[model samples]
Target: MISQNTINTVFETARVEEVIGDFVNLKRAGSNFKGLSPFSDERSPSFMVSPAKGIWKDFSTGKGGNSVKFLMEHSQFTYPEAIRYLARKYNIEIEETEQTDAEKAITDVRESMYLVSEFAKDYFHRTLINSEEGKAIGLSYFKERGFTNETIKKFDLGYSPETWDALTKEALGKGYKLEFLESTGLTIPREDRPFDRFKGRVMFPIQSMSGRVLGFGGRILTNDKKAAKYLNSPESDIYHKSKVLYGIYQAKQSIAKQNNCYLVEGYTDVIQFNQAGIENVVASSGTALTPDQIRLINRLTRNITVLFDGDAAGLRASIRGIDLILEEGMNVRVCGFPDGEDPDSFARKNSHDELVAYLEENSKDFIQFKASLLMKDAKNDPIKKADLIRDMVTSISKIPDRIQREVYTQECARIMDISEQVLVSTLAQLIQKDLTEANKKQKQEQKPFEVLRNQNPKNTGYSGGDPDDPRTGPPDGYMEEPGYPQQQQAEKVDILYRLERKVIEILLLYGDKTEEFEDVFLKSNDEGEVVMVSEKKQYKVHQRIYLSLQEDEVELSNNLFRDIFTDIIGFYHQNEKFSLEQYLMRLEPDFAQEVTDILMEDERLALHDWEGQNIFTKGKHETIAQYVSETVMSMRWFLVGKIIEELKSSIQPENSDNTELLSMVMDYSKLVNSFSKKLGRVMSRYH
Candidate 1:
C-alpha cells in the first residue's frame, strides 16, 4: 500500500498541465490551457486544463477530473498505478506499508500481464548484455548496425537465448505464474511443454506512451530462408499493435516541442533516427497506417513527414496511407532517401547535420511528391494522365478543411499542368458523391426503426406504454397511481436535481470564504402569532450553507451529491485550512471526479476572450455572499414547493375526512409563498 503522505507529496509537486501536456499539445488560452481531447477525435481543441485548480475537463466527452484521474482515464492506469507513475515522474520515494493478501489480490489481471511483460523485458535485456550466446549473436547484430552501447540501453534492446525454455523456466523459478506468462505471450503454451516465444532473436520492447512495457517486437539474427525475419508479440490485454506507435513514449516531448513528427517503417528506423539526433520520430512497426495510430500523433502535432525508403515500388505502395493522414486534417510531407537506402542504412552512413539537411532539402508536400512520382508512369498518355489527376483529386478531397482542399487542388493542377477550374469541379463532384453515400447509409440504418414505428403507431419509445396513451394504457402488470402524472416525473426530478447541484457547487467553490449572511427563521411573537424574522451574522460560506440546510431539514437528493456535501462539511470542520488539492486526494476517484466537475464547470467560459471583446464577466468571488444565499434560498424554495405538491396530492376528492390534508396544504402553500418572496428579493439584489 502506498502511504498517504507520499500521495500528498506527489499531488503537491506534480503540476496538472505539466503532466497532461506530455501527452496533449496544450496551448495557452487565458489562464487555462486548451488542447485536442485525447479521448475523442476533434479538429478543434475542446480539452481544457486549469493549473491553479489542479483539474482538467474535456468539454467534448464531459470527462473532468484532477491529474490522477486524467491518467487513470486516458492511460487506463489503476489508482496505485497512477500514483506510482506520478511519483516516478517527480522522483518521489514511495513509503509502503505491508499489503494484506486481499490487497495483493486487488492487482487486476491487466496489471498482472503488465508485470509479466515488464519482467520479460528485463529478462531479455539482461540476457543480451550478460549471457554469452546473446553477446555473440544479438550484440554483434546491433553493433554491425552502428548502434552504440548507450543507444541500445536507452531503448532497452535485448536478446532471447537459443534455448527454447530459457525464459519460461527462469520465470517459473521466480514464482511468476505460468498463466500470466502465457497470457502475455512471453511463453507459448503447448500440450508437450511451454517454451520461449522469441528464442534466438534480438528483442525490442514496445511500450505505451506512458513508458509501460506492453509487448515486444523481435528480429532474427540468421538469414534462414525458411524463417520469417521478424516476429511480434501476439495480441494480449496489454498490447494492441494497431493502437500504439513505436518510440512514442520517447518521442512525445520532442514531437510536441518541434511540432512535427517523422513517420518511419520499422523499429530500427526509430532508434537510428533517435541516435542521429532526430528525436521526434516514430515507426508504424511495418504495419499499414491506422486511424488510431494517426490519432496518437495528432494528440501531439498536426504535421507528419513520412520517411520512405528509396525503393520506387515500396514508395508507390505506401503512398496510399498519406490519404489517411490527410483525412485526419493533418499536414503531410514526404521525404525519400537515395536509391537502395532506407532510414536505418541512410542514418548510419550520414552525419547528423547531413541527415537533417537531406530531410529539409528533400521533403515535399505529399501532393507534389505523389504527382511527380506518378507522372513518369502516366507520361504522354492522355487516359493515364487523366486517371492520375482524378487520383490526386480524390486524395485532396479527403482533407476536412475546405480551404486546405482548395489549396491542394490548385497545387495538383499546377503539378499536372491542368486547369484549376477543371480540378475544382472534379473535387466538388467527389465530395458530393461521398456525402450522398453517407446520407444513403444513414437512411438505410434508420429503416428498421422507421418500420417498427409505423407498425406500432402508438409507440411512445418505452417498453411499457406511456400512461398518457389512453388507448394502450400502461403495459400489463403495472398500475397508474393517483395524482402521479408519469410524464412530469422527469421534469420534477430535473428541477430539484439542478437546485441541489447548485447548492453543492456553491459549497465547493466558496466553502472557505467568509461572508455576512441574513439568516431567516420563523418565531412566535408576544401576541402568540407566528412571524418570519431575519438575523444578520458572519459565517464561513460552508458554515452558512450547512446551517441553512440543517435548519430547513433539507438534504441533497442525489446520493453522490449528498455524500460530497457531507464530506466537504466534515473536512471544513476538522481542518484549520482548506486545500483543494489535499481535499481531492482524500476522496476516492469517483468522488474526486464529481468534485472536479462541479468546481471547474465554469472555467470553460475562460476559453472565450469575452473581456478582450469589451464584454466583461463577473467572478463568483465578487458576489460570494449573494451567490451563497441565493443558492441556499433556492434549495429551500424548491423543497417547500415539493412539500406543497405532496400535500395537494394527499387531499382526496372522494373521501369526506380530508380536513387535515387541506390544512397541511394551505400551511405549506404559505411557506412556499414566503420562500418565493425571499428568493425573489435575493435575485433582485444580485441583478
Candidate 2:
C-alpha cells in the first residue's frame, strides 16, 4: 500500500496545469487556461484549468478533477501507475510495502508476458546483428534502405531465426509460462506441436503511446511464391490493430510541441521520416484510420498532414480518410511523393531539407487536393461534374466550424468552375438536413420519464387558511400574496448562500487569524426568577461558529456546504490552518462539481463582465464581491445573536441567589457586544 505521507506529497506537489500541459497546448484565459477538449472531438476551447483551484474542467465532456484523476482518465493508467508517473515527474522516491504471496501470484501473469516480449525483442535484435543468415538477409535489406544502426535500434527493428521452436524452447526454459507466450502471439500451438510465431521473419514491435509492447508485425524474407509478404499478431487483450498507431510513443511529444502531425501508411514510412529529421510522424500500419486513432491525435494537436504514395490506388484510398478527419473536427492536408514513390522511397532519394521543402510546397488543404484529383476524371461530363460537386459539399458539411466550412465552399466553387451561390445553397441545404436528422434522433431517443410543464396554471377553487391568521398572512398584512411560498424559499436560499460564503471566506483567508472573543454562559433554569449565575469562557469566533453548527439541528440543503462544514469541524479539532487551495486541489470531481454549482448559482448579472471595473455606482453595491461580503457578515451576526438569545433563556433566578448566575448574564452580554462590534467592522469595510 502507498503510505499516506506519499499520497499527501504527491497531491501537494503536482500541479494540474503542469501535468496536463505536457500533452495539451493550453493558452491563458483569465485566471485559468483554456484548450480544446482532449476527451472529446471539439473545435472551440472548452477545457479550463484553474491554477488556484489546482483542478481542470472540460465543459464539453463535463469531466473535472485534480491532477491524479486527469492522468488516470487520459492515459488509462492505474492508480498506482498514475502515482508513480507523478512521482517520476517530480523526482520523488517511492517506498512501498512488499506484496504478499497472493499478490505476487496475480502479478506473475502480466509480468511474465512483459518479460517474454522484452526477451523476444532482444533475441530478434541479436539474430539480426550476430547470426550469418540474419546479417546476410535482414540486416542487408535494412542497410540497403539506408537505415543506420541508431534508427534500427530506435524502431526496435529485429530478425527472427528460421529454426522452428528455437524461441519457444528458450522462453519456456526461462520460467515463462507457455500460455502467456501463446496469448501474446509470440508462440503458436497446434494439437501436438508448438513453434515461434515469427520464425524466419523480420520483426516490428507494435507499441502503445506509453511504449508498452502490444503486439508485433513480421515480414518474411524469402521470395517464395506462396508465402505471404507480411503477417501481424491477431487481436489480443493488449493489442487492437484498429486502435494502435505505430511510432506514436516516439512521436507524441514532437507532435504536441510542433502543433502538427504527419500521418504515414507503413512502419518503414514512420522510421524513414524520423530518420530524415521529421519527428512528428506516425503510421496507420496500412489499416483504414479509425475514430479512436483520430482521437489519439486530437489529444496532441488538431492539424494533420497525410503523406501518401503518388500511385492511383493510394490517392483513391487516401481521400476517404479526409472525410473521417473532417468529421472529427481536425484540420487535414495532403502531400504526395513524386509518381511511383512512397514516403520510404522518397525519403531515401532526397536530402532532409529537399524532402521537407517538397512536402511544404505540395501540401494542399483537403478540399483543394480532392478537387485537383477529381477534376481530371470529371472533365467536361455534366453528370460526373455534378456528382463531384455534391461529394465535395458532403465532405465540407462534416466540418464543425462554420467559418472553415464556408471557406472550403468558396474554394470548391472556384476550383470546379461553378458559381459560389450554387455551392453556398448546396451547403445550406446539407446543414439543414443534418440538423433535421439530429432533432429526429433526439426526439426518438427521449427518456420515458422526462417532465414537461405547462406555460400557465389556474388558481385552485378553495383556500383553507383563515384571512386573519398571521401564519398564513403576508408580513405586510395585505391579502396573502401569490408566490409567497416561493419568496420564502428564495429568502432561505439567500440565507444559506450568505452563511456558506462567509464560512468559505474564513476558511480561505482568516483560518490562521486568532482573536479572543467572549463566550456566553448558560445557568440552570431554576435560577432565573431570583438571582443570576454565569460561567465565562474565552473562544475564537471561528471556533464558536464551528461549535454552533455542531449544536444546531439545521440541515444544509447544499451537499458541498454540508461536507465543507463537516471538514471545518474536523479542522477546528486539529487547530491547523484551513488550506482552501489544498482542499480544492484534492477534491473529488463530484464534490468539485457541487461546489461550482453552488458558487455560480443566482450570481448578480451586473457583475457578469465586471473585470474589476466599477461602472455602476449603486451605493455600497459597486461589485459582486463586496455585496457578497456584506451579506455574509450580516448572516454571521444574526447566527451569533441567536446563540446569545438561547443562552439568555437558559438562566433561572428563582432557584437560588447565586453570584455565578449574575456573572453568566454579564458574560453573555459581553459576548453579544463583542460579536456586534466585529460584525459592524466587517460591514463597514465593505460599505
Candidate 3:
C-alpha cells in the first residue's frame, strides 16, 4: 500500500499540465490548455487541461481526470505504477509496504520489460560513446550523416555491437532477465542461447510520446542485399508501431505551441529537422501512416505538412496515404525536396534559415500539390484531364469536415477550370455512399441490441442518462411544468436517471460540506393522527441526500447511478471526514471519469465569465441548502408521478383492485401536490 502522506505529496506536488505534458502536447487556450484528444482521432482542439483545477478533460472522448488518472488511462499503469511515475516526476519519495511475491511478479513483468528496454537504451548509448568498435562504426556512421554530438545524445541514438551475444551477455551478466529481453525483442532466443537482434546496427530508440523507450528501430550498415536495411522491435505490450509516432515525445510541446506539425518519413528526417531548428516534426518511422498515428499528431495540432522525398512515383504512391490525414479532418500541405534530396540530405545541406525558408515557401495545399505533380502527365489530354479531376474530387471527398471539403472543392474547380457544380455533385455522391455504408455497418453492429429493444419496448425509451447531466432531469425531452404530460416508465426512468444523477452530483461535489437544512419530522397530534412539522437542522450535503432517499425508500433506476449512490452512502459511513479529490481516486475508472466530467464541465461558462453575456447560470454555492432540498423534492415529486403513470397504465376501472389502485393513485397525487407547494414549483403536467 502507498502511504497516504506520499500520495498526498504526489498529488499536491504534481501539476496536471506538467504530468500530461510529458505524454501530450498542450497549448494555451485562454486559462486552460487545449490539444487534440490523445484518446481519439480528432482535428479540432477538444482535449483540455485545467491547471487551476488540477484536472484535464477530453471533450472529444468524454474522459477527464487529474494527473494520476491521466497516467493510468494513457499508460495503462497500475495504481502503484502511476503513483511511482508521479513520485519520480515530482521528486516525491514514495513510502510503501513491500508487496507479496505474487503481487511483485504480477506487477514487475511489465515493469521489468520497461526496465530492460531502458537498460538496453543506456547500454547502447554507452557502447556508442565508450566502446572502440561503436565509435569506429556507429558514431562514425552518425557523424558522416551530419549528425552532431548534441543531436546524437538528444535522440538517445546508439549502437548495438556486431558480436552475436554482446548485449545478451551484458544484460544477463547485469542480472536483467532473458525473458524480458526476448519479450522486448531486444534479444533472439535459441534452444541453447540467445543473441542480440540489432547486432551491427546503429539504433534509434522508439519512444512513446512521453519518451519512455517502448522499443527500438535499428538500421544496418551492411550492404548485404539479403538483409533488410532497417529492423524494428516486434510488437510488444509496450509498443504499437502503427500507433506510435517517432519524435512525438520531443516535438509535442512545440507542435502544440505552434499549432502545426511536420510529418516526415525517417528517424533521421525527424532529427535533421529538429537540428535545423524546426522543433515541431515527427516521423512515421518509415511505416505506412495509420489513423492512430495521425490522431497522435492531431493531439498537438490540426495542421500537418508531409515532407516527400523527390521520388515522384513514390510521392504519387504516398498521396493515397496522405488522404488518411485528410480523412481525419486535418489541414494537410505537401512539400517535396528537389530530386536526390530527402529531409535528411536537404537539412544537412542547408543552414537553419535556408531549410526553414525552403519548407515555408514550397509547402502547397494538398490540391495544389496533387495538381502540380500529376498535371504533367495530364497535359491537355481531355480524357486524362477528366480522370485527374475525378481523382482530386475523390481526395477532397475524404475530408470529414463539410466546410473544408466545400472549400477544397472550390479551389480544385478553379485550378482545373471546371464547374463547382460538377465537383460538388461528385462529392455528394461519395458522402452519400459513405453514409449508406456507415448506416449498414451500424445496423449490423446493433443487430443484437435491436432484438433486445424489440423484446423490451421500455428499453427503447429507457436510454440511460447522458454523461454530462447526472443531476436533476435530462433537459431534453423532459421539462417540469412545461405543458408536458405524465411520464411513462421509460421517461420516468430517464427522469429518475437525471434526478438521481443530480442528487449524486450534489453528494459528490458538496457531500461533506456542512450546511443548515430543514428536517421534516412527523408527530402524533392529540387527535391520534400524524402531522408533519419542519424544524431547522444542520447536516452535510451527503447526510441530507442519503436521509431523504432512505426516508422515501427511493432507489435510482439506473444501475450506474444506484451503484454510485450506495457507494457514497457507504463511504460516508466509513469516514465522516471526506475529501472529494481523495474519494474520486478510489472509485473505478468509469465512475471516476463520470464524476470528473460533471465537476469540471463548466469551464466555458466559468472561464469566460458567461454571466457577463447575461447567461442564466445557477448560483451553485450561494443556495447550496435550498438547491439540495429542491433537487431532492424535484426527484421525489417525479417519482410520485412515475408511480401514478404506471398505475394509470396498468389499472382497469372495473377490476377488483380498482378502488384500491385509485386510492393509491390519489395518495401519490396528494404527495406530489404537497411537495410542489414546498418546492414552490407548479406541476403543469399534472393538470
Q: Provide the TM-score for each candidate, comma-separated.
A: 0.89, 0.72, 0.83
Return the TM-score for candidate 3, rounded to 2 decimals: 0.83
After best superposition, candidate 3 residue 227: deviation in angstroms? 1.3
Error of 1 at 507 (Å): 1.3
- 1 or 2, which is superior by TM-score? 1
Provide C-alpha RMSD values for all models, in order. Answer: 5.8, 9.7, 5.6
Question: CA lDDT of each candidate?
Answer: 0.86, 0.73, 0.82
Candidate 2 global lDDT: 0.73
Q: Which numbered prediction scores highest in lDDT against the true structure?
A: 1
User: Which ten-residue region of model 3 has the weakest summed lDDT?
Assistant: 476-485
Models sorted by TM-score, best on top = 1, 3, 2
- Identify the leading candidate in terms of TM-score: 1
- TM-score (C-alpha) between model 2 and the true structure: 0.72
Question: Poorest 10 consecutive residues of model 2 by lDDT?
Answer: 600-609
TM-score of 1: 0.89
Q: In candidate 1, what are the lDDT values of residues 390-441, reduced to their tens digit? A: 8989999999999999889888888888899999988989999989999999
How much RMSD separates candidate 3 from the native structure? Answer: 5.6
lDDT of 3 by residue, 380-460 (tens): 899999999989998998998788898999999999999999999999998899899999999999999889968855434
